[model samples]
Target chain A: MQRRIVLDLDLCCGCRSCEAACKAAFKGEARIRHGDIAGAAYLPLACKHCKQPLCLASCPVEAITKDEKTGLVIRSAMVCIGCKSCAFACPFGVIDAPLVRHISQKCSLCADREGGPRCVAACSSGALQWLSDDEIKRHEIGMRMVSKDLFFRRKA
Target chain B: MKNINPKAITIKKALCPFCSYGCEFGVIYDDFGIKGVEYAKDGSSGGRLCPRGSAAAMYLNHPRRLAVPMKDGKPVAWAKMKKDLTKVFGSPKSTAVTFDRNVTPEEYAAIIGFCEKVGIENIASTYFEPESHLEPFLDESFDVSNLQKTQLVVILGDPFNQTPMVSQAIIDWKLKDRKNGLIVIDSLHTHTAGFADQFLRVNVGTEPLLLFALAQKNFEGIDATKVTGIDRAIIKDVSRRIKDSKNSIVFACLSFGHTYDPALCAEGISELEGYGRMKIVPLVEFAGYEGNKGFGSIMEMAKKKKIKYLVNFGELFPFYYPQVAPDLKNLEMYATSTLKHSGYTMVPVPLTLEKEGTVYTSFGKKKLLGGIEPPSGARSIEEIIGPLSGGSGKGKQLSVPDHKLDIKERARRISEATLVKGKGLRLMGEKIAFNFLGFFEEASLKMNPADAMELNIASNDIVKVTSKQGVEHMTVRLTEDVSQGVVTVPAETPGARKLFEYDIDTDLRSVNFIPTEVKICREE
Candidate 1:
């Protein structure tokens, strides 16, 4: 029932349009981060929204909580003490306190928006997708087959 | 701090002033000021904007924005600044004005009228290459809408960085028509190349040669692999695919040095006329180029005679014309009206978002800047230049010069000529990142992974790049996108300008296409 954001690494061109769209949708904060891996692969990293939610557990003040309906990990600025505990606990490094604002910030998956995240809408290459758990599994299978084909072709 | 209520927000339609495309966007403003920007549904961009367009509001109220007029690095009153300007323009014959391409039509007309009245003949706009490239293509009656119907599309350079909307349109068309072929010919593996069905990484300044070879349908005796750094078979295959397509269009950006030979490429593309329909679309990437007609006429007159006093409006003098900076300093008087202080007789001016005027889009359509007020005290070009014109000068009618048609001979000569191999690395300028002002920043030397390894250089290491013009140290970035023997720096950086060879020819005045050879060494 919960939605997850999946990225197809092969489709991304490192344009960072999703990052820009996220910043525009939010108030000057981009939840999604784009970078290159040793000049070979383009990576667009965002909140994975793990079932355990390490960031939510690590918050001493209980400022980070998981949404009951969408299962998204949300951070509250009102209760946050700017201790950066959630940022240090999160394994993915998606949560961080912006220099201007002391509160820790991360992607909310555009929970309030009608459709989904703005990053998904802004992706021109069809690399980013918001889908249910079952849909993500099926999409991952298809992507794996394509990657395998490309890998074998390169090897040949 | 004033809390911005969502209910009190007002959406105003405005044009993106960054590039020449002039795509429309809706500015979300409150009583405090601009809050954010959104894509307009009925805009030229079709409800999509580049990263810069999405963050347009930040640039409008930048912390460093020029709010008041300054003289000798100190703020001055409007009356005193006007008196200083009058003193400079008192000698009309010796005074000249040059403006950035972002001027509105009415403001441009006012500047032209002022120049005519003052008999100032040394005025020129920042963007002059588009005048030569776009004029000839537009005269041929090339329609951009035809891109959707084309079966094959060829991009010369990175239009995605310059004109994202145009690039998106071509990509969307390709996605819809699965059989359509897309070819990207560039020195680096640009973002546009990611969507390309075939990407040919050619050597710098060798675009004309490859295009000529394709037109001749001959690759005899020459090692195509060595000259173009592309396989001969791939070239033959792409050429065959181009010839076989029904409708083919070549989208060429005028920002690159290789694109200076647009006439040659146009002629080469025309060779496919018998097989199929072919057209060339000259892409103008910068804003306000359409209003540069008045500025172009002044540049022509200045070359014919010497001028002493000069005024610059919204134009970055040394950034665009580095060679003329020394000459400008030697003048009797020099004044600049700009958003950022460049240390001339400074007169602060408002940006496009703060003014109401008409601007010509890259597509040659008229668009209005819809804001009601100029930023508290800042004045528009018309408000400043109008009073100085004395109201006696009528606007001058400008004409675009005809493009020379003797490109076939040059193409043949190029095809017969040998590829010149330079020692060490070939340095090129590329657009890297868009900052708050919609201009490129983070200038670094992007080297190929192989070249980086050979030089014992790692990513993010500082390196010294030396050209005949000068030497500058820049951080090194390793990437597989660039070819092995080439190093690329951000086109907007000072290091890139050092590679430029100054030529007063109107065609090459604004664009640098000469292949600059540089030596790169690790800085210890």
Candidate 2:
């Protein structure tokens, strides 16, 4: 029952709605996680919900854990201390530093809201999508057989 | 959130008044005043907002903004303000006036009318007409779509990346399926040069030499070790790229006013033609400003005639064309402006919603007098243009518009009629967006080009920039990236204007300091 965020490159118009929405959902203002050029591409990224979570293993305080019900990686805010371990451990630099509060924060898929991740909802281009593990795997397998470049491989 | 009315958050499509890139922005108004602003969806800025546009809300609410109209340096009511303005301009006297073009068209017309009534219509001057074209950018025939076909692009004065939209377009073109090469010939390593395939750091003001040498395929003194301070092999490599390209496009970002050497562009035009189909594009800064270049063309025509009364707005004819302003001392002057030096100065624009009523329209118009709710204070350009165009029957005579009123079209009509007869060639129209204005404002560094990495100059540290006409003290800003022998200051600042040598003398005080190779030193 693991959930992974799926990307539809075709729908991704290179508009930065997800980036802005992600910042607003987690933090009050839209803060770019990295330099502009890095985020220029029309690629939306989220925790892959890998069979082995790199963040959970990397957390020294055991602050990060995969939810038993959803198999989604979750961070324990109360127990967590701001350390660079989880950030270094995760290959993808999804780890973000909240501008207001000096603490580590990441996309929680807007767990507090009933409607799901705010980024997914606010994306006017429908570039980012929520998907179950099976669907993500199926799409990846289908996409892999074709050109690996998701943006250019779309069939006419 | 104490029973906040949904109507309180009213979003009005307010035009950004900073630059010629008249970006329509959505100003969010609450019952209290302006809350925030966002880029209007329909305007040239699209949904993207730049730092200037984003910070506009702060500018609107800044405490230092001019809240009340002023007459003789003191606050006065709108009626008294208009009366004082009328009295000063009532006589036909030659006066120098500097005015901003952002005044509503209605105010523009009213000011023009005021000038005519007072017989001061002949010497009205504003910022350079060509520079102001950067605002209210119009869709031009010479567009990016035309640029895509180009294989070569050259930038002269202003760096491109500092102006992002244009830079982004050029970048996209360079990174296209079949990459197009870019050549940046500038004095410093500008951000625009970063994306260029090759950078030619030529000596400042020596663009003419570079162009001539390139045209003749002569490498006499252009050796990398000598001219550009680069490896000899690198020069050969870049020259090879230029020579090998089939379709070459040359771009110069420096204003024709500052650069003054049109022959270099002519040489570039000729060289590009030799290769294949080459086009030379002048990147003008103002909105509907292409019309101002027509004035330059007109002044050339006027030299042969015995005509009088050259009225300019958002333009300074003498500074733009030295051949004109000096000979026209008998030329009557009239204009309304926010600056202190203008022959007719009105209230300064204070930044805020509360003090907004204090700022009058460009024509010294008070808010809609005795009207309910007063139309929210900000006047539209169209409102000002109508009255000045003689709709009110109080202003000078103007040619009637045959078609629906458009600023670009009206400007063209006026330029055509005003041009000393028989010389009117249409120049290409230009399109600039609001966000690009933000980029220009944000990207241009205020540091002096000569000094680097030092800041502790005397509090009012003025640097002397000596040309033949004498020396002027410009405020100094120190940064590393600025090159020696070049001084970069904000073009709009008062200190910078003082540095601008506006004189008729060819050998001394000529505005063409580029050719003079004047040295700048920190003033004691």
Candidate 3:
């Protein structure tokens, strides 16, 4: 029952449209808070939903927890302060400073929405996707067999 | 200075007429005209600019803007201007006319009919790609993100500081690591050169001579001392330096000075060229040189099969020929360009900044520019071509095939597809992003403290930078920070280089040409 975000590395043209769209969805209500140039390169990461949850341990107030049914890490922003201990505790730099708000934040598995992560929805190259853990494993096996070298050899 | 009056300035939202950087600026003005300029924080440039943008007001406020069209030698009113335009070919036939700068959208439509009636074969709208249409074909892969994997980067004649986004990229590249070190080869010391790990200073015009010298050492001959300024010891040092690098890149802008022997330059670097590990990126001043080459070559292939009249709307022809300034004929040509000139003819573009248009080419699509609407009765190059080739009634319809997709969206798709396939890297595959390309186009790169030298030229000294056309002269700026042999002048000025003499006899050369011959002399 575990869920995952599928990535098609080859299909990713690296437009960063998803990054902009995601920033806009949360922050565009007032104004774009991030003063950094709009198109600058970014690594938009999400949690792997590890078996040993770091968020659960790092949260002193117990504001962060994992959903056993879907394996999605959930965060209660209402109880959280702006202290960034959770951001530091997460091994994968998935936590982003939310726009113009005084609270720690990370992807809550797009909990309010019906679809998957908004980043996947806005990706122009179809490089991002949400899938069940079983589906991800099957796809990974096929991808590994089709191209032995996705990250190492080819340089363009 | 204390007596000068200050004027209230207005921040105009107009896009920069330079390259795709699209920087915006505030124009300080009064009854006296445009006074000065500052970067527009809210505009495309995001409040930062190169020297050119900082000084745009000078060029635009220059006294010599063409207030009226000059037919032959007489300045006429708008009424007569249109009549003359109509008389040029009688009725709308098949003829194309390129404009200098600034034409309204409506006027653009009118000119199309003029070209069609005049029987213009093919109209090349320079307005569509001011610095030559290199934008539309750009993919997200060309964005700065690709620099993560970039190893060895090379910049030729272009100095990134002279341009905008490219300079920012250079600063970013430095933040990443010296792991992605830089190599710059040029006649003069450029801002791009200052940032390089290795700098190759070649004699002017003899850029080819230096390249040939390198090739000779690698293969045919070894007498490097006789061929170039660099001695055998230096060549060996340079050769070893290049050989040691795995992902080496060699690039040149060929704008400021000359690298006449690009083929030789390519061959010299060819020693380091490969499909993946090593590559050459050309830094071009004009936009769309590569894309235009692709389309033009294709059209040529079709021409061989008896195809006639290519209705080029969103395309530009590659200026394959080396950059050369227009020859100042019997009538003394005067211009103010980035390269100041002196002597026989007057250089104008360099002396003052003009309200120029911007050029954009992203994902292989080209957009010339937008500015204060051209004065009534004026025409744009696109308008001239549309009517000539049977364009839509008002020239409002884009020449793109009927699909209704936005040009920007289409261009993005094209860029994405090409990048995903990664096949188009064929012109020596080491993926050259926009910043890297900017590094190559502006050959005079950043220079280091030790490597840098103050040019002999001094401030206000009338010096001429020449090409085949003529020589242009301007007030010289002598800063020790500028690397020697590298002349740093603002390109924003259109004809600033017309003050210099060509040969002390007839003035018929300009500094606009690549590899221009320059001679500095004190005013008598």
Candidate 4:
């Protein structure tokens, strides 16, 4: 019933346009971080906004919370300390550790904009997609990578 | 400028001047100023923008934007600067005019017309990116959708990082069928290479040899297997597949210091283009306006004291080419810039985004709407040339020098360069959309894990990279993306770009280099 950002690994080319869009919109604080699969694959890691969020539980000051209706995990800059507990507690490691204004970087999913998220809009490869639960279930998310055709993979 | 609500947000549609894709995006502006970039859904790529396009507004509203004329690193009155420039142009015979990037085709034509009207003879292009070597392929613009029908695609450099807009189509085309062959040839294990049907990991600076071999063009003393570290049988089979394939395209995204013989590399692409009956699609960033001669000839004239006053009408010139600055010490430079740079008499000029003109792109020419006004104290090229005496005439088109190449000689030199054991890692330049102008991301060095361990370097270790031109500190990223003896740094940042050493090839009459020898040490 909720909309979330999903990544199609098969389409990503690791350009980092999504991060730039986020940083540009948020005044230089990148909520999304990047990871390399041993230089074999590049992934842009954004907040999964899980059903049972751990960042919301790890926040000592209770700065992180999830909206029950939209399922958006939001972080308040005013209520937060610079302790980085939420960043450490994040299982996905999507929360960036380096503090720009002494606050853990968290993705708000471009809540201010009407078009869902800016990362999906500026995705050059169309890899990052913000979709509703129904659309997410209909599309084959991560099954189309090299597993179907390992002939292209020189070394797994 | 329009009758709209003061508080309402508006987006001005403009073509991205960063690269040739020319994807249309919007600059979000309200009553205050430029807010950010908006991805236009109906635009070329259907709202998909690269990092460079996304950061356009950030660059436009950067704190370091030059808003006034500067001389000797000090702000000077525009009147005084204009008078001084007019006096400098009094002796147009000794003056030379050059350009690089950020100039529209109309602006380039205006510059050339002004040069002809003012009696300035020495006009040349100073843009020497390896992508410029792919100029011949730009006669016809190919759409990205063509890749879907392509039976094979042989990519030269990392298109994923250099030009990310094409990556989606490439991936879809590769996955739509099982037989769609994708051959990536590079020294590094790039993201595109990971998706490659066969990645020919070549020796450093030996890509040209592999290309030539694939084209079936053999030269004396050139054993592609020995020189490029790629097996000959594999090369032969891949070459056969490409030739046998019905539709094939060779996508070139060359970077600075990535090739030793750029002209020869272009020739190799040409050979492949003809042999395989395929088209050559160069992912050009910006094909700069050319002059009657190459920048090498202009530099020669400057060194000989023939050119005293150098006036550039582009964003990058003497500033980006730090290595060529010392040679032109005898000459005076007055360059136009949108961002604050340290050298020369910088004339604050409006970026192409604010100008109403046409720009040459991969998909032919596109027009800049010029809805945005020029920054205060900044002027356009046409406005700047108003005071100077000249009746505008259409300037000459790209009269590029004919580079005659001897395949055997180039192969020999490249083979020798690859065979020579260097003391340090071979520093190759890379381009990433996010690292454009170093505004979005910091420069990081990509090296192989084996090479990193040998130098006692770890991932994220701050390492001091020393090249012949300069030294700079970069965070090291240990990955198999780079070859063992090769390391790549994005050339978008001046700190990393200046660390590259450039050489002017005599035969090509163009500047090119294979890779710089950079010694890296972990900063304790």
Candidate 5:
């Protein structure tokens, strides 16, 4: 089953636990990036795992690819040529360019762990959730801002 | 065949010692060594770990983990160190014994036993962080279930960043009811303050004044509104609501250099707690223990050159607080530490994480399993103080000096102190678990956009901050969270910590690292 990690901006308190988990697992390079909306709301961004991956297309050595079985974006360290192309081509700006050993850092959704991404698992608040496409539809992620009180999520 | 793999992996459980939450997780080890930490779903806090808890594996397997004694950046033999210490102990009258964090309750008792045998009368605690003043508030056991049932919650500082494990509980409770009231009082706009129904932004180092005002305690000459920048009616109104609320809690988490007087801040909490008839829960990295004599006595002796040798237990003391280094002239130091430092006689010792003992937490005392051994050559307190062999005594509840608080004098001083002079900025300190004692990343300075614009500094630009006591260089981050004429930094490292000024309050006879006045300019 295909899955994705989604962050609820309303619940995030800008504590940066997701990024710390990534940095702890990997040496110091955080694959999951942290961004804030003008110091108001914390936004934890991850790989979209797009159908047509831009990082795979930009890779000169064909190191970046998608696994057909799991529909997961994979970055192979052995085949990677340490080129900067993949870091630049990512539209979401999730890929970190200046990584240790000059290799492009990408999230594999914690391929070895059975649960899910370490970022989602280590989230201090229940802001980050691993959901299937069907489960994602159920949340209707931005329902509060669209239908309910726009200010409610901003406060409370 | 699955269980017959040559490199078998073993998982051992341990508690995080970074904060008072005392979270449990699993440490994975193979034939080579530690791999990483595993989230324990059945453990407390529902397997949720903060940045500090997640950094446990790295902290254990860090390259700088000291395995042997070091002197002047070089390894020293244990026998040589013992001989030097023994000779220094010849004059026990001039030798002082102190302890700080990273010490278990058992280790503290052992230290006291060692002091008695060695005739070292100058006993004091060197862990002088402002959070130490909040130790009394942790007496009441706070249940996580209480967050959901309480109608009103008052927070003193930013617990979201300091103790992230508790964020979900508070957040879940606030979302459950629209009528729930959350009040935050802080000097700067913090993440927790953003979610508050009322954010009372007080003047720097004047938190005690506002808190006292909330309790309806007044100083005859001091105007609280003029000093704290908070409206008097709002303070009264919030106090009334808290007094009338059927169920409420006052959660306090203090930061270093954030207040002018820490003990006084605790007094304010006491007053508010009495007025509201509510329970208090203080969240801190460590619930510190005090010594027979205050640390001020040691400083006074050092200034007069009456002390010759100073022996400190645990990691933080003199290394973390270099501002007090000048007073100890010609005083040779012997300190037990987990990491190596530039100067001082560094004895390799086991951190509390690697030792089996009980530590005080927000809820209660919890035992450490000591599943992992200390690095090679690192000795326990039992071995270091072996000559004075005695059974470790019970963990004594040491109390801070609770003398009569002179409200008028303190209030007047704080009111006048917060009046920032023109072209000067007040430097405040805050605690961040992600910074992790500056072991992972360098400390950054947060400045108001207006101040940054005036200094011609931008984000990511280096700035030099100079105070009367010391100077520091840090990367600048401009934000409106901080008001104008104020700059804040996570004073986690030695360099950042050295910049702040300290005070030895004559009333309580305790040391307090208060916010300092500084001039900031873009570094060329």
Candidate 6:
């Protein structure tokens, strides 16, 4: 089963514990970013690992690849040239070219480790969850059902 | 830096000293210092921690940590430093010691004993505020676990920002039982307010007035809409909810840096308890172990008598209230035992993870801290103060006096006092948890979206906030969370302290007041 990280914005407190933990785990590079949005809401942004990965298509040296097993968009530093094409092309803005490293870095979802991303583990609130595509679909359906029930109950 | 052997990993149990909630976490370490902190399923926290507790390991071995004692900006021998301290505080009666509340009970006892032996009556903790006169009504023994059983939970102030664990517990309760009522009463629309079943955005200092209105059950006379910025319908609904609930818990967030009459709030809770079983849990943000061990008494003595010399254990004074620095400087000599250089006769102390002793939690429970020895040349408070006092006696327990409030008289006083009104904006201050080298750097002013628009100010724009006392410049963060007339700044920021007006509450015998008025403008 393919795994993905899901962030429920409603439960996120914007404490940035995930960012701190990710940075610590990834040698000072935070794979996730958290910031406030309009209407006093906070959001955490990370790589979506899309089916049509823009970063993979935009890389000049074909440095970015998609993992078929995990469905994670993996960026390889070994094959990448010091070019900014992929960083610019990614819609999520999760990729960055560090001045010190000269290579682009992004969230790898902690695929090499046991368990999932450190960001998920570090989340104090149960806002960040690791789930398969089927689980995500079920979660969405469950949330929709709850909202519908509440709406009908209020109307009644 | 030394290479850590992953094979030699050891888990050491300790309490997080960042805040007073005193959540215990297991420190993962190898041959090197603290590698990481793992949540320990114990204590009031129930195996949960905020970002501060999780990131404590990074702070423990921070590059700028002081490892040795210094004199006049130069490293000094421990023996020489002791000699200098003896000279400065030759007559113990003329000397006073002020410290942070993170002190272990043993250290606090030793310090008190030492002060007593030296004929010194002046001892104070940074956390020492005059115990609220409203202490009698506050239920000190209210268990945190009882939140789960409560049908209604009323949270005053943002515990989600101040004490995350407590807020998490409330959230958990609400999530588990959809029928449970969670009411958040705050001046601003705090993050926790989003989760509330009912959010009452009360005016800044009118918290006491609203509470008073609730306590007296006289909703008729008071214009609830004008006074509290809450509609009368909502007020009646909340009152009915409180009246009907079998078990209700009110969690009051103390130490929010903004003052509201806690006594009046307590009185309201007491009134609600009359209708049914109600528990009032005061959530103080800082650990007051020093305050628990006779620090309040020492403060009382200091006010009555003149203290010639003041020696501070840790960087407590500046962190507590920078205004106290002038009074400390007035003393014949001032010294500090701190983790960083404070340009005084400095004695280095170990970080919480590097020392071993018991620390008091905000809940008044004692927990063990530190399993490893302090860095060489550094010492714990007990080690220094213990030897100085000749180890004669243990410290006295905290004596919280029970003062009965005349609710009628307090209501009269509340009505008589001028409410915050004018062209200026309301100033609110909050204590942000994230810090580096024990100093808060993320100081910014939060403005309401409407206010920001009226002033032609945008997010990240530097703005000038002018209170009666002084003016400060801070970056603007516009959000709809705050009301139209208020601006909130982090209380620990450099210039935020000067904005507050200090009034000695004769009844409470404490010098604390929330400054409510300020004029905001965009900086060109």
Better of 1 and 4 by DockQ: 4
Sort order, lDDT high to low: 4, 5, 6, 1, 2, 3
| lDDT of model 1, residue B9 | 73
Kindly list the per-residue Cα lDDT of model 5 for residues B1-524, writing each as its tens digit: 34565468888888887777888888888877898888887778777899888888887888888899988889989898878777776788999888888888888887776667667778888988888878877774578788876899999999998888888888778766767888999998888887787889898888898889998898888888989999878988998998888768888888888889887788888998988887788888887778877888888888888998898998887789888888775688999998777788899998777899798778899989678877988988878776534444333545555578786788888888876464578899888777877756688999998888877899999989898788888999888888888999886556787889898987877789988889888888
Candidate 6 per-residue lDDT over residues A24-122, each given as its tens digit: 556666678776554546667888999999989998888899988778888887998859788899887878777777788788998754557767766
Query: Positional deviation of B334 in candidate 5, in angstroms?
Result: 0.8
Cα-based lDDT at residue B227, candidate 4? 92
Find the 10 residues in a row with the least total lDDT in model 5 chain A: A147-156
Q: Give TM-scores for every candidate, taking all chains together and pairing residue i with residue i.
A: 0.82, 0.53, 0.46, 0.97, 0.95, 0.85
- Model number 6 iRMSD: 6.2
Task: Report lDDT (CA) for all predictions.
Answer: 0.64, 0.43, 0.40, 0.84, 0.83, 0.64
* Candidate 2 local lDDT, B1-524, one digit each (tens): 67767575667665444433334456667778766554455755453343344545555654433445444456556565445444443334423223344443344445556555544523322344222222221233455566676677766544332233244356556555345666777655554554455667664434444553454344332332443344556656655666776556665455422432333333444554464344555454333211212232233334544333343444233333333444454444332222233232334432222122222221122332211111233222223333433443234323212222232232222223222222211111111221222222221223442333343344235755655334556555444334543445444322233333332212111122122334455667
- Say which docking band candidate 6 falls in: acceptable
What is the DockQ of the complex in model 4?
0.67
**Candidate structures ordered by DockQ, highest first:** 4, 5, 6, 1, 2, 3
Candidate number that wins on lDDT, 4 or 5: 4
User: Residue B441's C-alpha lDDT in candidate 4?
Assistant: 79
lDDT of 6 by residue, B1-524 (tens): 76666678787887777766777777777776667665565644544666677667765665655677786678888888777777755777777676664466666677766766776655555553322433443344566778777779887777776666565466557666668788888777776677676777787756666654544365434554576767777777777787788778777764434654555666665666675456777666544433322333444445555656667765555544555444445454344443554456667777655666665455665546657555677777766665666654776744434456666665544444425356777787664443322232457888887888888999999888787667878899877777777788766454666676555443544445464678877889
Local accuracy of candidate 1 as per-residue lDDT tens digits, B1-524: 77767668777888877666667878877777777665565876655666667767666766656678876678888888788788777777666666665566666667777777766655556553332444445423445667777789988777765555565567557655557778888777777776676778777655655765555444455554666667778877877887787678877764433333544554554554333455767666543432333443444445555566667766454445554454355454344444545455666676665567666555675557666344676776666766765553446533334435555455444434326555778776665333323332346778988988888999899888887667888889777777778787665454465564433434323333444578888999
- Candidate 6: residue pairs that collide: none
- Tens digits of per-residue lDDT for model 3 on B160-266? 53343455455455434536666666655544555566666654444444554444333233234543456678767665655676655554454422332233344
**For this target, which candidate reaches the highest lDDT against the unseen true structure?**
4
